[model samples]
Target: MAEEGQVIACHDLRVWHGQIRKGYESNKLIVVYLTAPWCVPCKFMAPVVDELAKKFTNVMFLKVDVDVKQLKYVPIDFGVDCGVESMPTFVFLKNDVVLDKLVGADKVKLEQLTERHATIVVYFTASWYGPCKFMAPVVDELAKKFTNVVFVKVDVDELKSKAVDFGVDSMPTFIFLKGGDVVVKLVGADDKVKLERLTETHATL
Candidate 1:
């Protein structure tokens, strides 16, 4: 068993399949750290990833030693099409979807990516709406400022059903979701402070 905030190493094929499947099925964000023992860059980023695992307790960090002969076919089966071709490739996944990928030992990008996908904030907006246009920059700024929260901008015109499902009548509506459930809903473009405050609140939770 893995200690709190530590990366769970995938040395066994069955154990690896279980971890990936469970994490995806539950809508939890997962970071697959693909590495090999002889790779110097992987060595450099191992500690960095470990620290991130500790920082983002909500995110699952899984380490895969590519050199393990028994785990040779794991990457191909991991849904990272074409398998992992680079050392220290970080694949960010949620609900079996590849949200993002990073190659090499770029510590800053690694942390930023991990934090960005840890939590979600769905921003519902319409392109034709003036208020939505006004709030676009504000939302972008908030996303940049709050690295730990993901900002999903959905256009009402494009996804009318989604907007209706969220009960969004306004041009801009911010829905804070935890584990696919709505925790907070803000309907307006006038209050940037409230938006940022709420983002900070739900993100840290």
Candidate 2:
């Protein structure tokens, strides 16, 4: 549970939804963290989210506990009709409309999604895989260089359901999307040169 002026609880999801609606009536932005109690990653991200809320006063940070009985209406309210498939899923909203979604615990990716206001890039990878290991730094570097791009590294091994949902069959698969449409897809550990070409050809960045 969060203290006063801190994280908003899942029980208050509906109330916060109304508040966000009102805030949106005034053209304000709201950031919601949709999580579950049993999720280890969500537990790990609680403090980080708390600290970020304190830092960004203008942006409202609302925590939605998926496990909460009353909060079952969340996915529908947020337009996630496909269903709440992963934990620590961060949904960004502006004027009561969902702008983007982050399916895992990647602080940098979350920040960039908020900053850029662009489509999210979900990278399917794994920990033990060698190519994934090699491409991790490259993806990080690209995220740094391309500040507008939101890069999310999804561990296929950990999030098998998510991988299956995205139809990811290979390790180190890159899915670049713009406004929910996949702009590009790359499988395997892409080198810097190949990445540059892909970025230029597809994303035009």
Candidate 3:
């Protein structure tokens, strides 16, 4: 419904920049909701993000319809390397660099995660792995409790190239990254208590 570069009114305006200079010069804190039209979760999270934009005046909210030709400039203009396997990929940018990213519509958790600088927990797994299924619930629960940490899951089967780049040799591999560097890695389904302790130990350092 919203056209490229057209500022739509909800709670904040969605800026589709024609050039990187325009996008970068406007603000320091930019939240871009890269979405598609048919995505149900995107439709649901749109309003929630708008509400958050209203609350956080320091940040600017923008919507990029991935379906549009104009939106293709994202990867080239911004140096974003990730593929859009799913819709409603929320990317938090600070000074043109990706600070945080959320793949799905976990609105409450996403808001909390983006509120501060925190460690990122990335779970790399495949759907076929039984251990991944076992780990999913645990990861979900941990994400809910750890508001300061950003939790992400990468389906290795779907994103094979990414998995290879990350050196994921097994299923349900959890990588804890701080400041874009890998600090710790836990292979397979791990105890929730131990995971929490690992996060705690990292957070204090």
Candidate 4:
């Protein structure tokens, strides 16, 4: 099954900070949005943030209200780190450390930033397919080589429902997923070296 994306609202300062500390890991990206209730641009950008949250399951999407007078650090904690000089600032972090920042409601930049951090691979196969059996070892080797990327194998016969969910109509189809989106699709059991090259090209970017 595909992982679902989420957006968490921060109502408390220390509790949200602690939660972020616990959830922040190397394999996932943390996206913190600094917004305010009175800012028109922030209000307009709210839906975009929600959409990004749904699209990027590997990202931790957080929304913080700067005007909420109740919280202390939630409003101004990472102003410098995130370079938040304005409302609706987007902060991207990795391993609890700031990696990138974006200002305003730019949908294109948001998608680009999310793509840069997500890494995943999905293989769709069936027992009746001979090429799928041949490609099993290559997939296993890829799982070992790309430790940072998630590798998934779906049996078309065993999980017919899931295969339909992923829109898989053929056997031995390989899907390259990033930020909960399919970036590439292959219909046959391609060569092992080409698979590695594909993974490397995406992983490094």
lDDT of 3 by residue, 27-103 (tens): 33556777777888888988887776554433456777766665566644544543545567777775567777777
Most lDDT-accurate candidate: 1
Q: Least accurate stretch of 10 residues (summed lDDT) in model 1?
A: 76-85
lDDT of 2 by residue, 28-140 (tens): 34578888877888888888888765644345677887767777778657655324357778888765567788888898887666555543568898899988888888887
| lDDT of each residue in 139-182, candidate 4, tens digit only | 88876665445566888888899778878898788788765678
Task: Estimate the TM-score for candidate 2.
Answer: 0.50
- TM-score per candidate: 0.57, 0.50, 0.45, 0.58
What local lDDT score does residue 34 receive in model 4, on the 0 to 100 scale? 84
Q: Which candidate has the top score in TM-score?
A: 4
- Between candidates 1 and 2, name the one with more favorable TM-score: 1
lDDT of residue 174 for candidate 3: 82
lDDT of 4: 0.72
Candidate 3 global lDDT: 0.66
| Steric clashes per prediction | 0, 0, 0, 0
The pairs that clash in candidate 4 are none
Query: What tens digits encode model 1's per-residue C-alpha lDDT throughout 53-166?
Result: 787755788999877888877666654433344787889887777888898889999987876667878899888889888999998888667654667789888899998898
CA lDDT of each prediction against the hidden true structure: 0.80, 0.69, 0.66, 0.72
Alpha carbon lDDT of residue 180, candidate 1? Answer: 57
